[model samples]
Target chain A: MIAEVLTIGDELLTGNTIDSNSAYIAQRLTERGYWVRRITTVGDDVGEIMSVIREILNRKPSVLVISGGLGPTHDDVTMLAVAKALGRDLVLCEDCLERIKQFYEELHRNGLIDDPTLNEARKKMAYLPEGATPLENTEGAAPGAYIEYEGVKIFVLPGMPREMKAMLEREVLPRIGERKFIQKKFLAEITDESKLAPILNEAIERFRVKIHSSPKGFGKFIGIIIFAEDEAKVKEVVEFMEGKGIRFMEGW
Target chain B: MIAEVLTIGDELLTGNTIDSNSAYIAQRLTERGYWVRRITTVGDDVGEIMSVIREILNRKPSVLVISGGLGPTHDDVTMLAVAKALGRDLVLCEDCLERIKQFYEELHRNGLIDDPTLNEARKKMAYLPEGATPLENTEGAAPGAYIEYEGVKIFVLPGMPREMKAMLEREVLPRIGERKFIQKKFLAEITDESKLAPILNEAIERFRVKIHSSPKGFGKFIGIIIFAEDEAKVKEVVEFMEGKGIRFMEGW
Candidate 1:
């Protein structure tokens, strides 16, 4: 399956924050056998976010993962943008509101909060797109929203790394099921990538595997990654390269 | 001025690499008073790269900074994609070629290279989009490229962080000129962001300054950023917030 990640925040666009959340999501998705095609980050502008969502939805990847802008502030517009793009109304999820209330009550008991009543900003976190299911947020007040649009599974999670990670692990991963990918890495003490480029290209074409070579500076070694769903094809390319007198190191 | 960043590499999409390049470029641009609107990352695919370029070009940001895929490997397709997107041919830049040759000659003299002769893959780095100027690379073999399309300034730099940084500092920064931005950050020990959201919204509307409040964990403190082009407006908002019993800390 193919997946794409869209992250939204003005802080991210202005270099105020580095998007480690997308990297974490991509890594998890890749581990689950999803080929992440693209990762796009936009600011908190609603128009830009909506246009990007429309574009990505046009691509119709099997899964679209969105993160960020799920806070209880003026700039938190991810849910609204998604609703506008999907042509859905923003509706309050009662379960999500109950959870937020309970969370604040516990915080108030622990002296973390002065009031347990759901304020306007806190109630904003309970609203999701119509017909969307609210994903439980174990770490934060803003519950994530999930919806299936035109056969594409769209998952919207918070931008905070801690909250997003907990929700992803608990809510998103289980539904993705299990799949394995064939990937191998070979390191060789080759000085020139230009010299090995032709052979690598030939192996890629012959075995139908994607081969990537990174030259580790001058006079060091070259790292090669052979990735494909066909394990046998990757092995064939590796054997071919080894037969060409390239000494493969123990690990990448 | 508005700016956007595009980072290209398959390793980035596969989660093998985190894109620090975009953040670096965005920070530099932001410091120069350019409001960075979006940052897009795509894998080493020609079609995807071309489509993203077309999309960003349609947005017509004042500046577009592109990094990565300027290497001597099969997956290095950024230059080719840019050329195709602009309907320009891939022409060998003589200046860039000379620099590549000199770079290899120095490597050979220092015993870092066995052959000083430019091979096919190395020569590929010398080819750039037609009518594009080459930016000298002080740290690597591949030279960067700069072009103007539809009144928008576009810069393509190397993917390697060291080389990209060197080229950016040396060649790119000077042409961008200097612009000052008024930005002040206030940290307050507040537990509830929801309670302060209305005040922040009013402050934003009153002074026309972009104010962002980041809740620093549970029951700790909130960091608020006040940004605007008008220094007087920022100061007025700061004073108003302080007058409203919000104890402002020393610094962000």
Candidate 2:
């Protein structure tokens, strides 16, 4: 399956943030046998986020995971953008509003926040797209949304690393699918990366496997990761490359 | 000026790498007074890289900095993809070829490699799109390309962080422009981010300054960054927000 990650935040665009969130999401999706086609990052602006989401939907990826801009702030307009992109209206999830209220109240009770009251800003977190199921956020106030629009599953997640990771594992992963591919990492003892290119190409062409090689350093070690349906296939490709004079050390 | 970054690498797509390169590029671009609108990451496939480059170009960004897939391996098709995207031809850069040969030969001379042969793989690094200037890579063999296409300045740099950073600083930064922004980072003493929304939005609207806010925690501190053309403009926004009862520390 093909997947795409869209991370929305002004911090990301201006480089105030390094966006380790997309990498985490991409790795999880890749482990689940999804070919993450692309990862796109835009600011927290609704128009830009909406335009990019529409473009991603047009490409018809099997799944789309959107992270960031789901908070109560004015710039956190991801939910509104997702609704606009899907041609859906934003509707209040009463259940979500109740949870958000409790979350704030609990924070207030613990002296973490000054107010336990729900104002317009806090109330904003309760709205989801018309057809989206509110994904529970056990770690944060913003409730994620899961929408299946025109055969593509789109998820809106929080931007905070701790919150996004919790929501993704608890709410997102269970919905995508099971992991199916076997990925083996190895360090190939090649004198240089260029010398390994031709043999690597021939191996990939011969075997029904996917291989990615990157230079580890100037000399004798290059990192190569092999992906296949089973261990046998990985071994076959490994043997073929080994026969071509590439020495391998498992798992660097 | 508006800018965008496209990072091409299978490792990035697979989440094997976190794409810290784009963040570094974006930060430098922002410091240079460019609004980095979007950052895109795609695999090392030629079609994928070319299509994304064409899309980014279509947006008419003032500058586009592309990193990754600029190596000697078979997957390093960035130059070829860039040529196709711009409807140009990949021509051999004679000076670049000499440098690449020397780079590899030096490694061999240092006993870093078994041989320093200019095979098709190694020679691939010396090609640049027609009419593009070859950017010197002081950290690696592959020479980057700087192309001025249809009013957009496009830079293709290496995937390695050390190489990309060196080329970006030594070659890319000098060509883009001088740094021209004043960014002030502050920790706003707010009860919650939700409460800071309307005031933050109003400050941005009143002053010609950009404001980005993210929650530091569930507590009374939220990180806010202000971007303005001058220190006076930033101070005006800061005072306006302070008038709204949001106490701010000088810096975080």
Candidate 3:
């Protein structure tokens, strides 16, 4: 299955913040047997986000995970953009608003905040793209959204690492798939680069797997990763190479 | 003044790598006064890379900085993709081949590799799109390419962070014009969100500046960043906000 990742935030485009969110999301999606074909980062821009979403939809990825811009700030326009892209509207979730109110009230009780009232800004977090199922936020006030549009699963998550991770584990992964994205790594002991080159080419030709090899200082060992549909396929490719005189070390 | 970043690597798409190169490039581009609008990542597949490059060129950004997939591997097809996207042929860069030969020879001398022969894999790094100038790679064997096609300054650099940084500083930055990208951050003392929201919105309205404000908790201070074409514009927005009773703290 093919997937795409979209990260939204001006901080990312400004280079003030490195987008570690997409990496984490991509890793999770890859583990779920989704080939993350394209990953895009854009600012907190409605038009840009909407147009990118449209483009991704046109490409027909099975799933699209969008991170960031789901905050209470004025620039947090991902939900609005998502609505517009899908030709929907923004609708307030009463359950989400209630949870947000209680979240702040609990914080107020713990002396973390001076006020417990939910202003318009905080209330904005409760508004999601119309028809999106509200995914509970265990770590923060902003709840994520899971919407399926035109057979494509679209997920909207927070930008904060802690919150995004919690939501992905609790709400996102269970919905993607059970197929495993299996890849096995090995260190091949090879003194001659020429001997291994042909073997590597033959392995690629024979097996329906993607092999990545990087020379580890070019001395006696090179690191190789075999990715396939299942663990057995990875092991099969490894054994085929080993049979051709490519010895695998105990560790990489 | 607009720039886009395209990073090519299977490692990046598979989440084996975090794509720090784009952030570093974007930061440098931002320092050179280019507003990095979007950052995209794709695998080493030539067709995928070529399609994305064409899409980026169609967007007509003033600059497009592409990093990665310049190494000597089966998957390193960025140079080929770039050539195809620009409707040019891959011409052998003789000087680049000489440098690659010498680099491997030096490695062989240093006992890093068993052979220094210019094999097909190593020699493949010497090819470039027709009419493109080879950008010297001081840290590695592969030489980067800088080509201006249809008014867009396209730079293709190595994926290795060290090599990419060296080429960017020594070669890429000199060719791009000198324009400062300045943003000033301040910690504004404000206890209420309602108090600073108007000031921030007003500041955005008054100056041609991009303002970002994040609450540092429900506490007495919020972080603000004013971004503009020049330093004076940023300072002007800051002063206008300060005049509206927003007290600035010394540090973040």
Candidate 4:
């Protein structure tokens, strides 16, 4: 299945933040056999967020994972954008409100908070798109949400790395399940990538496998990765390299 | 002026590579007063690359920086994609070819390369979109390129972090010149972000400055930044905070 990741935050666009969240999500999805097509990042502008959601919907990715902008602050507009794009109202979800209340109460009990009252800004986290199911957040205050629109499964998570990761592992990954593919990495202590181009091209053409050669340094070493769905084809490529007197070190 | 960044590579999409290039470019552009609206990443597929370029063109960002997919491998189809997107033919640039030839010869003389002859794979780096000027790469084999379509200035740089940074500083930054803006940052120890929401919203509504409050921890500290073109307005916000008896630690 094909997937796309959309990260929303002005901090991201302004370079105040470096997005490691998208990389983590993409890696997890790829390991589960989803072909991640694109990763698009935009600021907190509602129009931009809405436009991106509309585009992703038009593309019809089997899975669309969105991160960031799910916070109590005014800048946190991802939920509102999603609601507008899906043509749904921003409604207070009782379950999400209950969770938020419990979160604040726990903080108060722990002497971390003086006021446990849910203010307007804090209550905003409980307002999700109508008909959306809230994904419980074990790490933070705002609960994530999930919705299905026209065969596309949308997963929305918080921008905080800790919260996003915990929710993704517990809530999102199970929905994706898993698939098997043959992936192998081989390294050679050679300098120029151009030197390996011919052999790598030949093996790619012969075995019908995707090969990537990255030059680490001018005269140092190169890392090559061979990937394909067919295990036998990957094996054949390895054999071809061995027969060509090219010694490759194993492991990624 | 507004800007956008497009990063191309399957490794990035597969999460094998984290994109720091876009962050670097966005930071530099923001420092120069360019409002970076979006940062888009796609795989090595030619169709996806071309589609993203077309979309960026349609959006008409004043400065569009593209990095990655400038290598000699078969997957490096960025130049081809840009050529097709602009409806221009891919043509060999004599200057780029001479530079590539000299680069290999120098590497051979330094005992870094055994073959000085430019192979087909190496020659691929010399091709540029028609009417595009090649930007000298002081650190790598492939030279960067610059092309102007309509009013948008398009910069295509190598994917390698070292080469991309070197070329950007030496070639791209000069073309953008400089722009001045008033910016300030303050840190405060506080628990709930909701507590500061009202004040921040009032500041944003009253002044033309942009404010961002980042929660460092649950009840530890928050970093706030105020940015604008007017220095007096930024100062007003700081004075206003003092008037409200909100003590904030100085410095970014």
In terms of DockQ, the best-performing candidate is 2
| Candidate 3 regions with alpha-carbon error over 4 angstroms | A189-210, A218-221, A228-234, B191-198, B201-210, B218-221, B228-236
**Per-candidate interface DockQ score:** 0.58, 0.64, 0.56, 0.54
Residues B1-252 of candidate 2 have per-residue lDDT tens digits of 899999998898888889899999998898888899999999888898888999998999999999998887667889999999999999999999999999999999998787788877788889999999999999899999999988999999998999999999898888877757778999998655666878887987888677778766664678889988889988889888888899999776
- Interface RMSD values for the candidates, listed in order? 2.4, 2.1, 2.6, 2.7
> Candidate 1 lDDT, tens digit per residue, A65-180?
99998887667889999999999999999999999889889898999766778777778889999999899999989999989999889999999999999999998888777665
What tens-digit string does per-residue lDDT give for candidate 4 at B1-252? 999999998888878888888888988887777889999999887899999999989998999999998887667889999999999999999889999999989998999877788888789999999999899999999998999899999999999999999999999989986765555778866555666777877887887566777655454567788777667877789778667655688865
Write out the backbone clash pairs for model 1.
Answer: none
Candidate 2, A145-182: lDDT as tens digits: 99999999999999999999999999999998876667
Please state the error at residue A211 of candidate 2 in Å.
2.2
Give the poorly placed runs of model 4, Cα more than 4 Å off.
Answer: A180-183, A188-222, A227-237, A240-247, B181-183, B188-210, B219-222, B228-237, B244-246
Better of 1 and 2 by DockQ: 2
Model 1, position A242, has a per-residue lDDT of 81
Cα-based TM-score, every candidate: 0.91, 0.93, 0.93, 0.90
> Whose lDDT is higher: candidate 1's or candidate 2's?
2
Give the clash total for candidate 2. Answer: 0
| DockQ-based CAPRI category assigned to the predicted complex of candidate 3 | medium
TM-score of 3: 0.93
